[model samples]
Target: MKILITGGAGFLGLHLAKYFSEHFVGNKDFCSLLDIAEFDKKEYPKNCHFIKADIRNSTLMYQYIKSMDYVIHAAAALPLWKEKDIFDINVGGTKNILEASFKNKVKRVIYVSSTAVYGVPKKHPIYENDRRVGVGSYGQSKIEAENLCFSYIKKGLNVTIIRPKTFLGTHRLGVFEILFDWIHDGKKIPVVGSGNNRYQLLDVDDLVEAIYLFVVRSGHPQGVQRQQGHPKGDLIYNGAFNIGAEKFTTVKKDLEKVFIYASSERSESRSHNKNSSRQARTISKVFPTPAFFVKKALWLFEKLKLSPLYQWVYDTADKDSFVSVKRLTETLN
Candidate 1:
C-alpha cells in the first residue's frame, strides 16, 4: 500500500519508516515521508522520497496527500515546560494533517498520540477509558489534536489512535539519556517523590512494531474483525503499553543498579601475580575504558544536577503514568 509517514526523520518516525520499508521492501507501491526537516537517506532501507514540509502548511499538504492510501500522522511538536506560541504549530499542525488526510481520500490514519492526553491521573496504569485531564501546555495541545482526530472520525474517516508512554530510542533528546548518563558517571540518580512511582518506557523498536501492526491492520482492506486481538476501524485503543524491562527502578535506584551492574564484571588477568609482591606490568584493563569514562562523567553530572540531560530525570518525576499493554506479534519478523 502507498503510505505517508509524517515526521519520518524523527526518533519514532525513523524507526517506523525503516520497519515498514524492510517489511514491504521493493513490493511497496509508494512509502514516502513528509517533514520540514531533511530526512537522512542513509538511515532508510530504500531511496524513498521525503517531502520537507511542515504539517501546518495545508496547501502543500493537500497537494501531496490527495491520493495516499495510508496516512501515519507522526508529526507534532513535543510538550515543553513553557509555550512560545500555540496557534501555528502544535494545535494547528494537527488540524492540518487530519484535514489533509480527509481531502486526500486516505483510507486510514494511524495517529501517534501521547499518553499525556490523560494528565496527572488519579489512578495508575492510565487506561483509554480514563478521563483525560492534561497538566500543562503539551498535554493540552495533545488533547486538542486528539479531539480533531475524533471529529474527523465522526465524519467517517478511519482513525486509530496510539498513545505512547515514555519512549527511548537510539536518537532521542528528551529525558532518559540524563538518567542513563548519570548512572554511567557513578552518581546517585535522584528520585522526585518516594521513588516508587513505577513507569513504563517504550523502546523505539517496540513502538515501531506496534505502529507497523496498527497501520497494516487498520488499512488492510481484507482486515477481519477479531475481537480478541486485532483492533477495528472507527475505534479507539491505547497504544502505549507498560514496556520497561525486568522491573521498574526508581531514578536513584536505577542509577545505583546500573552502576553496580556495570562495575560487577570481574577482572580476567592478575592470576599470575595473585599473591606476589612483584612489579606487575598492566594488561587486564577493564575499568577506566572510554565507556567507563563516559559513565563516570554522567554520574558526576547527575550528582551536580547541572546537566540538562540529568534534569530530564527531574522532569519525569511529575509525570505519574505507566502503560499496561497487550503484546502485539509481528508477522514480518
Candidate 2:
C-alpha cells in the first residue's frame, strides 16, 4: 500500500505524515509527502519520501499520483493569504488534485476541509446538510473545492470530505504561537468579547485518528452491507462529515485552564531555586474587550494591513461556533 499526502510541509500535513508512518511500516507500504515548500527530512520518519512539487502543477501531480493506494488532500491557502492566491491554491489546486487522483484510479482520497464553510452561521451545532455561507475568499474557496469533490464522487471516485474545526497540537504555530508567548510572558490576553462563547477546537491527534479510521475502515455503516436497491460507491463515507472536540467549555474557562497549568509548571521550577531573589511571575489574565469596538479596530487594522486576522475570525469570536460530530462518530463506529 502506497500513500501520498499533499501539502506535506504544513502543520496538519506533518502530523498526518507522522501518524500514517507508524501504521504503514510494511516493506512495500511507502508514504510520499508532496509540497511546494522544502521539507525537513529530520522531522519526518525514514519511511516517508519527500517530493518538492506543487499541487497546481497538473502534470507533476498526475505523475506523482500514479499507482497510489490513498491520497490525503490536506493542502489549502489559509485565510491570511491574498484573495487571489487563496482561490488559486484552494480552488484551482484542489481541481488539479482531484483530476489527477480520478484519472490515476486512486483507491481513496480524503479531503481535509474546514468548518469555515459554515461561515458564522446563525444556528448552533451546524449539520452536514447546513447551507454553506462562505465569509471570505478562504471559506468560499473551500466550498468551491468541496463542490469539486462532489462532482468527482459522482464520476465514481472514492472521496471522503472531513470538515474539521480549528485544530491545535504539538508544533502548531501562527496565532496559537502568539497566544502561547503572551501566556508565557504573563501578559494580559485580550479577547474580542466576554469570552463566553463555546468555541470548539480539535486536537491534531484526534483528527489524525479520524482520518485513519476513514482510510482503513469500510465506508458502509456497521451491519449494513450493500444489497438490492442500495446506493453504490461508498456513499456513506464519501459525504461530508464535521469533526470537533466532543467536550469543551467556554473560551474563558479554557484559557483559565491553560493559565493554571502554566502557573503550576512555573511553581515546580521555582521550588528548585528557593534562594533566588527574583519574585515569581504572575499568570496571564483574560481581558475581555467590547466586541463592537474591537471589531471596528480589527477592521481598520486589516484594511491597513497591520493585522493578520480576517472577518471570519473576529466576527465569530463572541458567537457560538460549533458543529455536530454525531454523523462522524456514528459512521465511524
Candidate 3:
C-alpha cells in the first residue's frame, strides 16, 4: 500500500512517517512525505520518500495522491498567525487535498482535525456532536476544513476525521518547551490560578496508534453508515471523533510530574507509580499565578503580538478541556 502523509516534515507527520516506514515494511508498502519545508534525510527511514510542495497546489497534490492507497492530511496553519494565512492553509489547503484525493480515487484519507473546534469548551467530556464555537480564526478554520471534508464525503470520498487534543512528546515546542526550559533552569513553574483545572493531553505515540487503527481497519462491520441508507459500510467515519487520553489529571498534578521528572536525572525514576508517595510531596511545591493578572498580561501580549501559547494558557487556564473517546474506542474495536 502506498501511503502519503501531508505536512510530513512536521511533528505529527514525521512521527507517522517514521511509524509507517518502520512497521509497514512490505515491499509494496511505500510511504511518501509531503511538505513545503525541507527535512533532514537522516532523520527519516529510507523507505519513506519526501516530496516538498504546498498542499494548496492542487496539481501537485493530485500528482502524488494518484497512486497512493491512503493519505493522512495533517497539514494546517496553527494558531496565532495572520487570519488570512490561517484560512488559506487550514481551509484552502484542505480543499485542495480533498479535491485531489477525490479525483485520484484514494481509498481513504484520514483528516487530522483538532479539538480546538470546540473552542473554550463549556462542557466536560466534549462529544463529537457538540457545538463548535471556535475561539479564534485558527479554530474557525478547522471547522471550515471539516465542513469541506463532509462536502467531499457527500461526493463518495472516504474520509475519517480525528479531532485530537494538544498532543506532546517528540518535537514538542512552544509552551511545553517553556516548561522544560524552566525545569532545566530550576525556575519556578507558573500556574494560572490554583492550577486545578482538568486539561487533557494526548501523547504523540497514542495519536499515531489511533491513526494507524483507521489505516489498518478501513472497513467497519460493527456500525452502520452515519448517512441513512448509504450503500458503503465502513468506507468512511462520518463526522469526527474526539481523540484524547482516556484518563485525565488536573493541571497542577500534571505539572508536578513534569517538574519532578524534569528537574534532575535522579528524580526521573520517581515519576513512576512506585514513587507515588514521593510525587505527592512534590505536588505541594506547585506555584500559583492569579488568573486575573494572567488575563491582563495576556491582553497586553496579544496587543504586542507576543507568543501564541500565552493566549492559549489564558483561555484554558481555569477550565476543563478534556474530551470523550467512547466513539473512538468503539470504532477501533
lDDT of each: 0.64, 0.87, 0.80
lDDT score at residue 328, model 3, on the 0-100 scale: 91
lDDT tens per residue, model 3, 239-260:
6888999887999898787766
Error (Å) of candidate 2 at residue 105 is 1.0
Model 2 spans with C-alpha error above 4 angstroms: 219-233, 273-280
Q: Order of candidates by TM-score, top first?
A: 2, 3, 1
| Cα RMSD, each candidate | 7.9, 2.8, 5.0
Candidate 1 has a TM-score of 0.74
Question: Candidates' TM-scores?
Answer: 0.74, 0.93, 0.88
In model 1, what lDDT does residue 181 have? 54
Backbone clashes per model, in order?
5, 0, 0
Candidate 1 lDDT: 0.64
Colliding pairs, model 3? none
- Tens digits of per-residue lDDT for model 2, 194-305: 9999989999999999998877764424324432245643557787999999999899999999998878877876788777664338899999999999999998998788
Return the top candidate by lDDT: 2
